[model samples]
Target: MRYVTTAGVIALALGLSACGAGGNDSAAANGSPFGDCIITGEAGSSPLNLISDGVVTVKADLPSPGWYNGDTVESIKSGFDYCLLANIAHRGGAKGLNLQNSSFDGLVAGKAGSFDMALNQITITPERESVMDFSDPYYESTAGVLVKKGSTLTQSDLADSHLGVKQGTVGQMLVDKTIKPAKAPAVFPGDAEQQAAVAAGRIDAGIQDLSIVLGASVQSGGKLTVVGQIPTHESYGVMMPKGSANVVAVNKMLKEMKDDGTLDKLNSTYLTEAYGVDPTTIPVWSF
Candidate 1:
């Protein structure tokens, strides 16, 4: 339902038109299926049609720290996901970014409408594939148990603790399929609510991504801590509309980033440097 075209395409596989909208010769030479760059923008030419010509539409939950950063949606500036998208557009010859605000449940449910892609630490699963598309895995993650500092969650309450989880996340998946705690877990709209529940003693612990829990713990100034990690061993990927034409291009860009070590550098910059928590020290909590 949204417009999609290669960025900076000057001619339809020929050359720049008077209006300067077409295809990239290099892309055509490289056997790009889109034929040519049929658009023009501040960036160069590419071969894929995106949600918008000359711009990439990236769907995300505003204020997704560690993944993407902003005091608010309007203030987003830098983070792991932001840098990844910038490089993806740079490689594809797109020069613009339109960050669409949406919910995590919407993203996983394939209902976050009209964006080229979504990247909020999403994990790929076979069930989700029925309704959406996913690029090759870009990053790996595990679930962590967040508890108030000095809470007796691990020592004596493993089976009876009332857990809290962010809706539509691997944390919820773990609760439903693995943890099987004595009581039904409280599902929150987002991590902030889950963290609040834990802070208020409303839930014994909150389960979320290790990196996410670490960020929340640090921000809490020792009021919260990661008590243990669940070895979900999940890999995160970019989510797209089912059978989108952009999948090939997106995967190609991810492969290039992985091969060139750009992904690792981004991880270091945002995850390690920005969050400042090491996964190695976190104790593993087995089922």
Candidate 2:
């Protein structure tokens, strides 16, 4: 979920310690973006050769709001990632969509060839392409600031406040490069730790993806709220196993969705209507 600046930050943050992380424009030329593969079948007419019969399996760290929207697959009624993959499953001619819970770490490094793809807010990088295949870019995101409910701290307090960051993320990089808090940030391994820290008052704030912080605010039961955002140039794509056969089909579906307004509709349905927060209305804090 972290962006590439220091490749190692991506590795440690996402629990993929075995490789470095950074962007590569040559990914498709190197066959990581399905360059060697061609569209072989019509959408929804021919079922894919999936990991399961009559099903398209997508792995993600569930319970993430603005994305998974549920603590588990059975509880998921709607979400950006869940609905997005549901569309992909339908396009692939699968009768059902299988959303599985997995560790954000293991989902990247292990389970090669065991699932169809992953849509866990992952950014494509040359180092990641070494281990996984990526569909075309689908969504762009910004950094949202999460804080304690009813807290008086504003963006003005950011300079001296104890800010927390998920270890090895673009948010951390932005905090370091842009915000430059007087106190060094408290860094944690994943969303849970950072969220917990903010809720318990150990830190003044936590910064991560807009959807991530917003989702936390929704699930926080009035204990947390998002007060501001930092615009960041980060885009996410669907991740697949290294050299996956389905990458071509996934890309085809993505192109159609983007061209036909499906992507925009989903953004409204899940991020706005479902989550009750329009990212546009959140203040863009100037640090």
Candidate 3:
């Protein structure tokens, strides 16, 4: 089963400490907060939609990229996306759900107007918890290093190699806190940019989430390989308004989804079995 880690337990304690500050503004004076749950993600892209009649319907012109297959809504609605959707539908308390395009800054800070919940692979950290509430982790991931095939780069070389990491990501944090490369890390705009830089030989290695780097290795067609994985505690949670009563309800649904094997099926179909990467077989590198 998916149990919260030690770090997550501390986070929950800290979150409880702030209870004196009061619950989310959306909360009802009587108790629970239930209404039209507004789901949001970065603008210029459709990150969520309602599935109807076996077809995923999008509110925008483009569709959310849920998996490696395509940007089509149907193609993208597996894994975490499906887990979140299935839980919400199974819970059945909210008046309705609506999708809105928003800014990352706004969503991370829980100030994205009109949005009750936010998703999009956002990581939960203590700093962010001071301002927002996070649901139980839907995805657990670790840092992974991607390198050119047959490049013979060892774990020891990682500390001195020219590493590439995306700005404002956990990969960059891992590099700073654990890898400590001799030279400065080559910062890129995002995962795509960092992967491209590694592919072009602009950097010695690319550091990112295991799923991302593993997918890169598969798509590279024998050009790239995941050299190692960092043993770190990291998970993605649904961000919600701070002190929102919905947090409890959402967590319950997430746990139910996990217990019933729904989450395992989705992960197997979209990530583990489909990607052909044995997470256990991936070599572990410590900090």
Candidate 4:
């Protein structure tokens, strides 16, 4: 799972605050003050970034390198190049370039034309698909519950427990609708905080992406453990402006990555260390 930054939230809130500021003048001149294309995504996760007017901007909350086997900064640099290689090695490949180093200030400064694409652990939904074009899913994950090691909670005990979850995530939604705990679920901005809440016993358990929970648990040295699995499905995709020409180019390269086993190899190298399970072993979603 990806992380969200306080700055992004502030920016979004500010945008909403200014929605009626200029009105007709803003609308008739540049078309919209918000017309400047910007990509918004979970921060700190290696697999996503915000692109503004074609410039890549890093988010403030970068994921820790220990989360995956190939999560080193150097490995990320190399793995990102796979997108470029796919373009050169395959027909209709899209070109991608590294920009900022996953920082909020860097992204705001880099904003400029059409943000070619933004990739993160963005869940695909009919409402979103209606407004943006998305590449084939790059990763699949499920919602899961985590508790501290030696905690009394069991897989069958969480139906009545208070849960911690990142707001707006599938995990939170699942817990809200399925578990329906009496107390309102504690909401945090990112996985790190939710994990921390579980470790501190502030919350009886946490609901998050399985991969994120596994990675956090491994990094925490057995401080956390999976209590139960939430029956929710989610996947990640690369988002581009609807009907943009770059869509075809990006999809072509992604298809090549899929065909040449590069995607699988990357996942095997990174996800295995994080989740202690091969993503390939998971059943594919049939849509």
* lDDT by residue for model 2 (33-130), tens: 21112222345853466877767777766555656553344555455666677677767886566666665656666453378888877756564677
**Model 3: which residue pairs collide?**
none
Which residue pairs come into collision in candidate 2?
none
Per-residue lDDT of candidate 4, residues 45-68 (tens digit): 122223433223222223233221
Model 1 lDDT per residue over 1-287, tens place: 11111110000110000121111111224343222212212233335577678777777766566555545554455666776776777667765567767777777898877877777778788878889999988877677788999897773476688999888888899888988888999998877788888888899999887777777887788889888877786677888899888788878777766776677666556665544555666677888
Q: Which prediction has the highest lDDT against the true structure?
A: 1
Give TM-scores for every candidate, taking all chains together and pairing residue i with residue i.
0.82, 0.72, 0.70, 0.62
For model 2, the superposed segments whose C-alpha errors exceed 4 Å read 1-47, 109-113, 125-127, 150-160, 167-184
Question: Tens digit of lDDT per residue, candidate 3, span 153-183?
Answer: 8888889899998665678878987788899
Which ten-residue region of model 1 has the weakest summed lDDT?
A: 8-17
lDDT agreement with native, every candidate: 0.67, 0.66, 0.56, 0.47
Model 3: weakest 10-residue lDDT segment is 10-19
Q: How high a TM-score does candidate 3 get?
A: 0.70
Query: Which whole-number lDDT from 0 to 100 does residue 188 have in model 3?
Result: 75
Question: In lDDT terms, how accurate is model 4?
Answer: 0.47
- Candidate achieving higher TM-score, 2 or 3: 2
Cα shift from native, residue 265, model 4 (Å)? 1.5
Misplaced by over 4 Å in model 4 are 1-61, 64-96, 99-114, 277-287
